[model samples]
Target: MSRAFNFCAGPAALPEAVLRQAQAELLEWGAERASVMEVSHRGAAFEALVAQAEADLRSLMGIPDDYAVLFLQGGATQQFALLPMNLAAPGQGADYVVSGHWSQRAVAEGEPHVRTRVLVDAADAAGLYLRAPEVDAAAVDPDAAYLHYCHNETIHGVEFPAVPDSGAVPLVGDFSSTILSRPLDVARFGVIYAGAQKNIGPSGLALVIVRRDLLERAGQPRARVLTWAAHARAGSLLHTPPTFSIYLAALVFAWLREMGGLEVMAAINQRKAQRLYHAIDDSEGFYRNPVDPASRSWMNVPFWLHDEGLNAAFLEESREAGLLALKGHREIGGLRASLYNAMPEAGVAALTDFMGDFARRKG
Candidate 1:
């Protein structure tokens, strides 16, 4: 059976070549008697796998030696609390820039733990989830523990072109969808966390890259599992880690290395995004993307049919055509095509063809 083009926002598609490689290595890896999934994380083979994954990822993202890369479980969602617990102290506050659904949820998660300050407010704008409000750098608290923001608002289909520049405060970025899609300045962020499902590999693993100085800042009173320092100290092997997910992520890193790393991936991703956006543009409001052109996310593009009643039919037909997960997030009722790193150009072409056909049929 062939693979369907998946546009899922998260727990999303991975590179096909990576999957095929894993299948071949499922029973045994590198002539070893056991699969990567079956190997002990403490064993030398798995240790090398994990280390090599970090090193490859480090090179791709230009991660400096001053950072610790942790392959963890609990997804990026868990980092919402873990970050506040570890970084934000009792008296100090953290600024959260709320651009969309995930950002609002992140603010709520961090509120109880510390003094939560809203940086970018978009609450008054009706149905404008796709545009991030312009941030005022002067208004940011210089003494704040960390400034948090979602690099790509998955639900809203918005993205910040560059990381927010808040003076003296380390930036904590939730890069769940856009982690490896482009080259990133790892040094700019105090911490960056990403779920493995989207651009990296399967679900169940979250990769967190934290600056060494930030990890050494202070420890919390919670269980050892909750502290980034504890996890870092154990080399992300504290207790039973997500062995399978980590291994798959390693495979993906290897595949990325083979494809000339992130620089090449960025170009391909840009071409794919431009093609899809052009399709949306040519529709002449027959279908409309709500996001501001500058703030639009390359990973997920949500657009609406002028006739809302046609949504169900569009999804049904799209599935039949082997285009899957084209439904937008429920909170913002429209269609969303998450063109993650794994989505091939042909898949986007098929979706564009389907959209054009659907529009004509509706008309």
Candidate 2:
């Protein structure tokens, strides 16, 4: 059977070329005869692989030397707790703009560690976030440790069209879903972190690109293990790392380079999103995406069917048609198609075609 187009939010699609390369080298990697997973993380082979992964990512993202890139375990959720602990002083105020689910989660997780303040809550009258909130640099408290926002919300499908300026206060972003889907200005952010499952590779890994100066802020006292500075000092080799996930991520980074880097990926991604959104809009009332046009997500597109009764049938038929994981997140039930870096243009074409056929019969 052929591979189906997978649109899961995380553990999302990875480039086929990367997967093929990983499969080819799974048995014996490098000049040695052992699998990459079996090699010691501190050993020459794996260490070199990690170095190359960081270098490739640095090149791909144009990260400055002033920033220390750390590949850590425990996903982005872990970073929420660690962010305040590593970047903010105990009981210090940190401003957060709650645009959607993930940003809201970040506030909930960080509140215990710091005086988390809501700078902007983008929810409408019904508590639905259909747009990204306006965040002016003036709104950020000058005395705050940092101003935080999510780059994109996977469930609610609201995305910030531009970086929110935070003036002198360090600007932090939770860039999980939209990390590598396009080019980014690394200089504008103090710390940019993402879960590897969506655009990077697989689960069990989180990538943090933090400015070196911020690491010296002497945040709340915590275990050396939870300290971002400790991890950076050790070169992300302080303990047992997620070897397999890092290996896959390294391959993915290489694949992105071969595909002409982020600029090319951005064009392809925009086209895919535009095509899918056009299909939704052209269908009249058959389908609707409630997100504001200016703030609509290029990575995760969540749309609703006019008739709620067709939800089950839509899922069943979409599956039969080889369009996988069209179900919406439980928090907002409708439909979602996460177009990560790896989903091919052909997949979007096929999905749009399926939508048209389904609507013709069901509308």
Candidate 3:
């Protein structure tokens, strides 16, 4: 059977080239007689694979030598608690810019560990989550352990076009939805983390890039597995790690490099987003995207039809047309299209065409 265009929020689509390459090497990786997953994590072969994955990722993102790139188990949800445990001292507060569901959850997870101050929240007067609010530099507490924000809110389709100003406080970002889709200034952040299921490869792995000096702040005596210092010291080989996920992620990094790095990827992603958004904008009140124009996400586009009754027909016809996973989150019912790095321009074009046709038939 042919592959369909997938728009899942996570465990999302991966590059076809990466998938094919993995298939080719599934049984025997190079000269080794065993698959990558079967190999020992401490073995020379797996070590080399992990090292090369880190190197390629660093090169693609322009990660500096002072940063420690960790391929860790558990998803970004684990980082919510780990961030406060590692970065914040007892009773030390951390400023959080709550824009959407994920950011709010991060705050809730950190509250028991440390005092979480809401620097800015994006909910409107009606308490509806619509867009990311502008960061007020004056509201940011200078003495906070760090400032946390989500680069892109996958559920609400809100993205920060620029980094928030945190003054001297270290900036921590959750880039789960937007990582590798564009060029980023790695120096601007003290720590950046993402779950691999979206743009990278598969579920069960979280990638963390943290400045080396900040490792000293992981002073809280937590479990060995939860400490960033231990993971970094062990070279992310602590307790077996997610071998298969890391291997797949390595293949994806290689694929990204071959696709001309983030610069080329950014242009392609921008074009795809523009094309889809144009379709929504030109729908003549038939489709509406709730996010503010400035904060709209390039990765996730959530829209609602003027007549809500047509949603089921739209989804059913879209599935028949080979477009999968277009349903929006239950919290905010509508439709969403997740345009991650792996979604080709042709896929977006097809979706736009389908949208136009659906509107015409139902209008």
- Candidate 2 matches the true fold with a TM-score of 0.99
Q: Residue-wise lDDT of candidate 3 within 171-220, one digit each (tens)? A: 99999999999999999999999988999999999999999999998556
The RMSD of every model to the true structure, in order and in angstroms, is 1.4, 0.8, 1.0
Q: lDDT for each of the candidates?
A: 0.85, 0.94, 0.92
User: Any idea what lDDT model 3 has?
Assistant: 0.92
Q: Itemize residue pairs with steric clashes in candidate 1.
A: none
Model 2 residue pairs with clashes: none
**After superposition, candidate 2 runs with Cα above 4 Å error:** none
Tens digits of lDDT, candidate 1, 114-229? 88999776655464665767767787888788888889988888899878887778888899999999899888889999888889888888899999888877735678888889
| Candidate 3 or 2, higher lDDT | 2
Model 1: residue 41 alpha-carbon error in angstroms: 1.1
lDDT of 1: 0.85
| Candidates ranked, most accurate by lDDT first | 2, 3, 1
Per candidate, the number of residue pairs that clash is: 0, 0, 0
Per-model TM against the reference = 0.96, 0.99, 0.98
Return the TM-score for candidate 3, rounded to 2 decimals: 0.98
